[model samples]
Target: MITVTIYTHQDDITLDQLKADLDSLQSTVEHQVVTIDIDTDETLRKEMHGSTPLIKVGPYTLRPPFNRQDLEVTLRSAQDRVKYYQDDAEYIKRVERGRRVSGADRFSYWFSKQYMLVLNALVLLFVGLPFLAPVMMKQGLTGPARVIYAVYSPLCHQLSFRSWFLFGEQAYYPRELAGIEGVISYEELTQAETIDLNAARRFVGNEMVGYKVAFCQRDIAIYGGIFLFGVIFALTGRKIPGLKWYLWVLFGLVPIGIDGSSQLPSLAKSFFPSWMIIRESTPLLRSVTGLLFGITTAWFMYPMIEETMLETRKILGQKMEVLKQTQKANR
Candidate 1:
């Protein structure tokens, strides 16, 4: 059956008159009428606000000041069009496809609306677990702590020298080449070979030196920055405009790139000539670059995702409304 949907305010007197008109044509036309109150239904308010007493018959729509003759003509046209296409296999398939709003569609709708919460929670989990590993180690929970460390090992370099330490004399231990004065360097304390990458990664530190966090200092800063921006975005009701792409590249990508790339030459000093400049970045420089990259990247990305999700929500919302009308008509 063709569906006739009426959109209007609850107080609009024209709604009764429009319904009476539909009823008058009952002898000649068979259609289900679904009335929606724009004031109470937020989706309809957004879509059809100020355009009420609106009438929809199949694909045709009529606005205010329309008379009974206009309604009849539109309804008859809708009926004829339905009859013309009712027997076509393609039309039937299209109608069936449109009517089938599956569980996936419902899930997509829900996710689109609640994605920020999920993202924030994920960032929190990603950033929080690394800190928890060290705390667990300090508390003698070696089994679970090792598990966290192993899980994160693939994601980060996790070099003890480059990672933060908790429950010890210092929060971090950088290589002597970092040129951080006063504090004991990683080589001075551990006596490990500076060139031994495997040893650095394997060393989780002792009680005297403090256990290392599952993530490197830079990684912790990056994810922490992402989480911080996520909170700020939520607090501001996500209305903040996205950072411009060029600005993001300059502030987010360039510093991190330079800090990371410049450090690589020091790592592969064997490959470069003796004349080439080599330097190790301090914990402060690593953290600053990581934080800038994380915050600005999120600032650039989240707003774009929000825009896409919003459009998805609107499309799915309209589809949901149509599905509800279809179900009502079937009942």
Candidate 2:
């Protein structure tokens, strides 16, 4: 039987209203609806101390305030999925555990694998490329390095002054750009009498030339750090302890909140930097974000491989079964 439990705060939405809605839909579904007032319920209060208006069902929790129609739709979809999986258990298990070892069961397996590889490569490219600027510039391979910088331009403004320059003044792109135009050189731009858009902005500098990441030192560190963590965790087969997928979703999003809300002028400035720095520095924060990206990349590849291998095993198992049946028939 399908069960829905809705938890709410004191004087929020009334139980009568919820009951009325459930009664209205009673004829449409074979389900039971229960409401738990979190303010009064000691056990629920302790369990859901920070989270109110939380929904708890078997193996799934839906937090409010969600659209009632959407919730209903999800319930219906879930019910159907449960029924289908239960009905097909025997065959599903048979397919899941393959009987034979075979090569590329389908053409799509190769495509999925390729897509996953490309995604992983992109992740590494973003994570490690910034660190390689010095190495590339030293080898006179600034052309390829500039291409990388150009690719990341939309994502990061690539501020020359803000970014930690790897090499001396010669390694800097904006300085070189300043020289080429002949209108302004590095020394003239840096020592300008007046601060104007036409003159070099300390962070962005000449917008007319050169490319860089849109963010400052802090942002690159965070994103690049997360990407590197993902690569390591993917290799190590590690996961965050005691965090379900739902919790991880919330935890992963806290960084965005910490980073964005810190900029709001209304809030106390002290709270801003405190939360922002902690949010950025926390190992839990970085690891989870990395795991999320890595898992998404891995899922795309793992499923296709498993499915193809399963199909191949089934085919070989069928052949063996057929041979046995033939021998029995002949005997």
Candidate 3:
């Protein structure tokens, strides 16, 4: 006896055709073959819950769009196992030969892995750089650097309170720019104001230069974390112990989220100075990571290029072999 099965959730025209096909194959095969609708049998349906249209044929289940020849082959092989089919050994050998994976075929496997590195770099440049540039520059450049502000306007609110301003006329923050003093000329400075400034200079603490771009701590960590690791991965081919390993990257992301989220809600802020340090100094850190990203990307590219060269060499070698054979025959 030979059995094959297919499982599906429901029955319809497709199921009807499948059943009809199995009935037609009865004449060609020496065993009792029949199609059982799993949907019709409550017990079968429950037994295969969530997995439908179960095709059960002897020891193996028929998976779907059943190829008659493949089924016949399977059935024959099974029959041989029971001493029912005479040519079982030949059949087994044929199946084994078909399953063999050759050395040349491994090219695609290596190529797929390498391409992932390139994909990570592309995401960093297109999605990351534009979003992060303003945050990075807000503390370094002032006014007319409004260009960076304008560029980012579509993506974010660029709210005054959330933004950071840099040097010139008292690190002009956007909130101050919106107020009356925004357009004031230097000539309007009062002697009293200058006296007060000179007096207050000794007390001036380090000011917050850039408006906190609306992105809180976690946002920086996730985007920046992925960006950071991606860079190192690409540069070093994702081999670094501290950065490339998944656990360390996750560890690094924790502070990014903890610092950003905890402080944003006015909750307990435990991971501060470290958070601030990471946020402000990301460019340098990512620079190291970026080198890694580049390495990873190059690593991917190197193999693609090497394989193309290898393939060319293989073809050339084959041609040389053929030419040498011809020359020997001529001699």
Candidate that would win on TM-score: 1
Each model's lDDT = 0.86, 0.48, 0.43
The clash number for model 3 is 38
TM-score of each: 0.82, 0.35, 0.28
Give the TM-score comparing model 2 with the true structure, all chains together.
0.35
**lDDT value for model 3:** 0.43
Top-down TM-score ranking: 1, 2, 3
Per-residue lDDT for 1-331 in model 2, tens only?
4556667767665445655665666566656655556665344566676665666544467765555665566577657756777768785575344333235433433443343354447766765676665456556676775666656656653545334444443323333322244333444536744323333323332233333333445445555555554454445433322234454345444544554343342223354544443211222333344445344434433444445544444444333443344345447
Instruction: Look at candidate 2 and tell me the lDDT of residue 7.
Output: 71
Report RMSD (Å) for each prediction in the order shown.
Answer: 3.4, 19.1, 19.6
lDDT of 1 by residue, 150-262 (tens): 99999999988788999888988888889999888888887766567888888877799899999998898899889889889878877679999999999999999998888
| Winner of 1 and 3 under TM-score | 1
In terms of lDDT, model 2 sits at 0.48
TM-score of 1: 0.82
Q: Rank the candidates by lDDT, best first.
A: 1, 2, 3
Best model per lDDT: 1
